[model samples]
Target chain A: MSTMTMAKALNAGLRRALDANPKVLLFGEDIGKLGGVFRITEGLQKDFGEERVIDAPLAESGIIGTSFGMAMRGYRPVIEIQFDGFVYPGFDQIVSQVAKFHNRTNGRSSVPMVVRIPYGGGIGAIEHHSESPEAYFVHTAGLKVVTCSNPNDAYWMIQQAVASDDPVIFLEPKRRYHDKGEVVHESKPIALHQARIVRGGTDATLIAYGPMVKTCVEAATIAEEEGRSLEVIDLRSLSPIDMVTLTHSVRRTRRAVVVHEDVRTLGVGAEVAARLGEELFYLMESPVLRVTGHDLPYPNSRVESDFLPDVDRILDAVDRSLAY
Target chain B: MSQPLQPWGGPPGATPHADAMTASDEMVQLLTPEGRRVEHPDFAFTGDDAEIAGLLREMVLARRLDLEGTSLQRQGELGLWPPLLGQEAAQIGSGRAVRDADMVFPTYREHGVAMLRGVPVGDMLALFRGTSMGDWDIDEHRFGQYQIIIGAQTLHATGYAMALQRDGLIGNPEPDRNAAVLVYHGDGASSQGDVNESYVFAASFQAPVVFFCMNNQWAISEPSTRQSRIPLYQRAWGYGFPGVRVDGNDVLAVKAVTDWAMERARQGQGPAFIEAFTYRMGAHTTSDDPTKYRLSEETEAWRRKDPIERVKTYLLDAGAIDDGWLSDLDAEADALGEHIRSTCRQLDSESLAHRFDVLFREPTAESEDDRDAHLSYLARFEPLSEESAR
Candidate 1:
């Protein structure tokens, strides 16, 4: 195991995927020489050559659309959409074509493609730069949407996403890209759509994903000082959400609070709450609560902290749920 | 009035069709707008009168289907409909020209092509209804799903063509039986990066594909003037292939062109780019109001060159059908319209619930759990009985 930032872990994961699969090709804007704006694809183009690590034109839709054709031609294309907000330009290709190609061909053709997007807010970026658009892809069927909170999961999840048979929307938490964690270099490969229990407890369950996963873990640590035991489940997959893990945790804790960096309205938390209420109705001490970002565009850098949920907000929700 | 604007890259005295109709060209338009048949001498249409009538009937049906779809949109049964009102000649002609084995990649507005491929009209409406993604199997129909993203289909068609050729499927060396792909886009799509990249890949690999661009004058509110400064058809010559412009409203001309192109492709010749000069009689979609940007005079001028009306006029002039037969055809069209209206209504309630099933062929364990939870929650209103559960 090695301690590394989320960016380095992702770089290592991509290197492992490229070394494992000869067919894996990386294509995106500025991903070649610049190693991407975030440097997540650092040193890939130099090692893999231009053919495999293509620096595509600045068209997001073209990158994804052509990658679909490439995947059909027996190439496993791992595309980077650059940013969460920019993914909309390729929304038509991602939703209409990439997602439906399997069922449209009656399973004769499958898109073994991965679209990596850096999502969520808190970096205080410009307009359309810091947005959580996972709900759009998650709502659309035929897409497998997943996200990683820390370096270890980011490293393994990207490789798992690339290996999946169905098209996977791998959303990286841009805000958490530099956060450090111990990453196991080689581990038993996990399923792409399953949730992992980052920290186990007994008082209540704090479910989160992407950037909020770390926040939830921090909230759990703070809650320990306040004599509240909170379990944190990192929901790795957003689309095919791991309800089994969620329900089991809720059953054990008898209370749950879902958290995310996206707007509270119709966020992934809603689905989690609705599902928990139905499956584990008798196993609850209180109504399922959520500590999420306000339903507004990510505010300016000065007020961004007020818009995003932090350790205090998450712990407050836990206290409320425990009091009930 | 002004030297006919000399196409894109033609010679000083070159006729529009002269430079376009090369033997190696995939865009071999045979008929000129003056209703004159000009063959390539090397390639000819050998079909008899009966075959011509069948082709005309297909075009007529395609027009009827398009009209029916537009009407369905007006009735609020569809989320949107990109009307193929004036491009029937281009779609029908090219659709009929392709062999059964050849694959076709279509943009959103290829209703005529879908009809030719035998996709049920109800299935096509499902896309607009937002009830289903696409209803037909791409392999079985040999027609790709309607791609809403502009110019993306060109790459798919190119890749498929490459696969077919690489497999040595070009049977019988005497009259090469290689499969070809026809990818349809619009003049507006010509400005897209993917379309140009598709041209590069097709040229580089010598893929057996045809890039069919229907230059229908307008893309929503933007005119062809904004899309290109020159005729889009002639742009193909720079890409190492011939490009032709045909009066897309003329069904005969479009059929002649597409047929010749498909034959060249089957004979192992490379890709072709065709520019079908047509007009859009309606708005870009149901939400669009054409009156906001377009002039009434322009619409009226294009109406005179209506694809269906021109074919109807020529059929009557050639004594191909009498007034009674025309009336019977109108009645058939009316029946199709009625069927579409009723089918659309029936689909509203039935198609709304299948959104989950189409999400994944094999739903992940989590998705299965989600669906189960949703069903149980909905069951509270009317609990499921043993029979209902089964």
Candidate 2:
């Protein structure tokens, strides 16, 4: 086991995927010589050469469309969208082409493409740089959405996503890129599209994913000190939404709080809350509460703290639910 | 009948000057507007009368399919139809250029090209009929799913071409081992960001792709002139590839250029662009009204340059097929149309219930739940089929 940051873990995963298959291609803006803005693709171009690791033109739609084409031709192309907000230009290709290609072709053709976008509002950046666009992707049908909270998940999930036949929207928690953690690289990685219970408890379940998972875990520990045993569920997959694990946690706790940086309205949190209400209606001590960003344009980084949900916000939701 | 007798792309009220042919990279034409064979300096139609007749025959069949599709839409049998009324030769010529191994990525209106790609007339109408996008399983066909979004497939084709390049399919010692990609778009789509980006990537990577832009006078309601200040083909020069403007109405000219271009790509010469200068002789689709946006005089002018009409005229002029033969071909085309009508009618109305079936290679737990929920909801109504309830 090596102590590595999420960035290094992802880099290692990309290396392994490249080493595993010659047909696997890497394409994005500044991914080649620059090794991606986050350097997650560092040393890959140098190792794999220019053909395998491509520095594509600065066009999101082109990156996706071409990747979809490459996938059609039996090549697995992993594309980087550079940033969360930048993916909008290629959203049409993602929703219209990448997602639907498999369904339209009756599962005969699949876009085995991975789109990695560094997401969420932290690291004190500009408007477009810091934004949570995962909600939009989770809404799309033909794609799978996943995120990594720590180094191990980052290392393992990147490899799993690349190897997947379905198109995957890999949302990187840009804020936690430097957070160090122990990574265990095994012969086989953990199952994708399944949620893992990071912490177990019976009072209430704190559900979150990607950037919010770390935050929720911290919130659970703080909640423990407050005399409430909180279960923290790190939802790795958003689309299929590891509901089996989520239901187990919610059923045990009988109360839940969904937390995320995405806007509260029709967000991932809202979907979780809706599902819980449907499944655990009689067992619930209270309605599923949500602690999320306000429904407004992601503000400039100076005021981002005011917009982002934090430990205090999670505790407040926990308090509100316990009162019920 | 086409006002002032001036062919398009020239000065108003003037036939394309004889100097026009010699002026630029002369558009290679094997058949002229007058139905006479012409000799070109660079390209020639090497096909025998039988093969040439096949081209004409396919064009007629495609045109008949298009007419039947339009008629079907008018009679409420279809929701919409994007008629390829004038761009038959451009599609057929380029469609024929690709080998069985080579792939095609075409924009939505390439009905002729789709027909050549092994999708039948009725299967193609499945899109217009609101049954499915296209009836043929897109995975099984050499052609891609008909992309409605303009200029998007150009990049996809280039991506596929890039793969072809990396696979060492291009420049293979064995001719049959080599393969390339041909993508179709239009003048208006040239202005799209995706189309331009596709060019950049294809040129940068030296992808074996041919961008066949049917500059069919109008892009829906907007004119081609509004889309490009200079001739469209020259735009390829800016992207670092050889580009040509071919006679879209001249089947031989299109086939020759496309063939040469695809061969050039397989030889690792990078991508090639061809602007098939034609006209939209009919409305863009069943929903569009040409009278609102264009003049009838202009339509009359384009009708004179009709691709199928010119091919028929050429065949008759060469005594390739007599009136009796032409009539027999028409009878066959009508029979095909009848088959399409019957096939469209026979398609199960509730086929959309199987929407969840093709969603994934294997159904995910969530998708399975969704399917169950949907089926349960449908069962609340009188179960259309006894098996649908479970």
Candidate 3:
């Protein structure tokens, strides 16, 4: 076991993936000698050589479209979308070509590629810097959307995402990247698509992912003192949400509340609510409620607590669900 | 037939001329505005009378398809159609010149090329009708999808050619199996970074690809003058490749140039740049109003050099195709127009249930969840039948 930050864990995970698969390549702006702006890919280019860890041109669409061609030619390219906002220039390649290559080829071609974006808000950053745009990928079909909540999961989930044959949008919480935790480096691997139950309770289930996972867990601790048991499920995989785990939790608790840092309107929470209503309708005590961010761009850091779903907001939603 | 003395940076095998005329003179027109064919010995056409008639038929059918598609867009049957009104010769000539094995990458406005490639007219309509993005398999059809982003297809073609070369399909020691790729883009697209980068890559790698630029004189509201000070094709010389200007309004000239380039590529020669100089006789698209920027006389001048009429006149003068054959071709064109109209109507009313199926080959957990949630939500309004319900 090794104690490391989420950024360090992700770096370790990338190293392991490179060691395991000779075909795995890493490419992005400043990812070679510069190690990336976050330094998550530090020393990778030197260790793996320039072919495997490429420092591509500052062209997002060029990087992505050529990577799609490379993937067609049988290479698993792990691309880093420099920032959340910078991904729009490459949106055409991602949505039109990379996302559709598999289905368009009828399984003859697969984009076994991972586009890593360091996203979400809480950092005192300028405009276009701290935005949570995971909903766009989640809304897009043929893409597997997943995000890591802590160091251990960040370490394991990245390798798993790379190993999967599907194209994955692996979102890294830019704010929580420095948070430290103990990660078990193991030979045995976990499935990439399953949700993890971070905390178990009998009252109501709190489903959160990425940066909101820690907040939901903290909310559960406060709820425990108030004699209300809150089950917190960290939805690791956003797109292929482990609905089995969610359905089972909703069945036992008979109530559900989803939490996320993204805006509330048509968010992933809405999909979860609608799905639970369809599959576990009779078992529910109340309608599925969502404790999410305001329907606005991530606000200034001074007032970000109001925009984000903190512990009190999550617990309040849990209490509201129980009252119903 | 006398070959015009080659000016500097013109096609090979000619005496270089001093003080070549301006950019306007660089538009090497072999067919006059009055529909007379001038001959250049070096770039002469060896195609028989039957081949010329066949090329004429292709240009006519391509025009008919373009007319029908534009009408569909106007009638609200299609979301948009980039009208290929006056550039029929450029598309048909270049599209037919390549071998069956050679690949083509086209911009969104290559309806004429799509027709020549035998892509079903209905399948082309799907994209404009908003029923689907593109409805053909690129590998199976040998024609790439209509890339909307300008100049991006050039890079794809370069990459495909490089892959082909790497796979020993081009530049082999036997020298018989090499293939070429014809990638199409417009004058405005020549200014984009990707297009220039593609040129650098293709030249550096000596990939078997042809850069076909249809300088249609206008890109939406921007005139050809706004795109470049010199003729677009001449820019290829800077990239270490031969470039030439052809009368894009003349089907014979277009065919002669493209055929030579494709042959060169197949013979283990590197890339060639062919600029088919033509005019856009209509608005850029259904939503565009061309009267805003273009003068009426410019349209009238190009109208006199109509590609279909030039071939028709040549055929009539030579007695290659009689009046009866012309009448039969007109009937066939009318039937094709009607077929496209009816098929477009049918497509609008038909339910596109497979829209999501092509979203992924193997459904990811997210797509599966999304599919399940969408189906259940849809079931609330329209309950599935017992036989089909899950």
The candidate that wins on lDDT is 2
- List residue ranges in candidate 2 displaced over 4 A: B1-27, B383-390
lDDT of 2 by residue, B1-390 (tens): 554412234344543323232124556677887777788877787887778889988898888888888888888889998899888899899999988889999888998888887876666777778777564656456888888889999989999998888888989888999999999999999999999999998988889999999999898899998998778876776677778789999998899889989998988878988989888777899899999989999888878877777777877877888999899998999898998788777654335557777676645788888888887887777756656866
Work out the TM-score per prediction: 0.72, 0.93, 0.76
TM-score of chain A of each: 0.97, 0.98, 0.97
DockQ of each: 0.21, 0.66, 0.20
Per-residue lDDT of candidate 3, residues B312-371 (tens digit): 888888889999989888898999999999999988423333545556655655555556
Residues B14-61 of candidate 1: C-alpha lDDT, one tens digit per residue: 544433353233334444433344565444556654665666677777
Question: Which one wins on TM-score?
Answer: 2
Q: What's every prediction's RMSD, in angstroms?
A: 6.8, 4.9, 7.0
* Order of the predicted models by DockQ, top scorer first: 2, 1, 3
For all candidates, what are the clash counts? 0, 0, 3
Docking class of 3: incorrect
- Output the lDDT of residue B18, model 1: 33
Per-residue C-alpha lDDT of model 3 across residues A1-324, encoded as one tens digit per residue = 999999999999999999998878897999999899899999999999976897776777767765665565456789998888888887777877777766655455577889999998787777677788888888876788899999999999999888878789999999899999999986564677789899999999999999999988888999899898989998998887889999988899999999988888999999999999989998899999998889987787788868878888887888789889
lDDT by residue (tens digit), candidate 1, A197-310 = 989999999999999988888889988888888899999999888888888888999999999889988989998999899888887899899998898877777788898899
Candidates' C-alpha lDDT: 0.80, 0.86, 0.82
Docking class of 1: incorrect
lDDT at residue B130 of model 3 (Cα atoms): 77
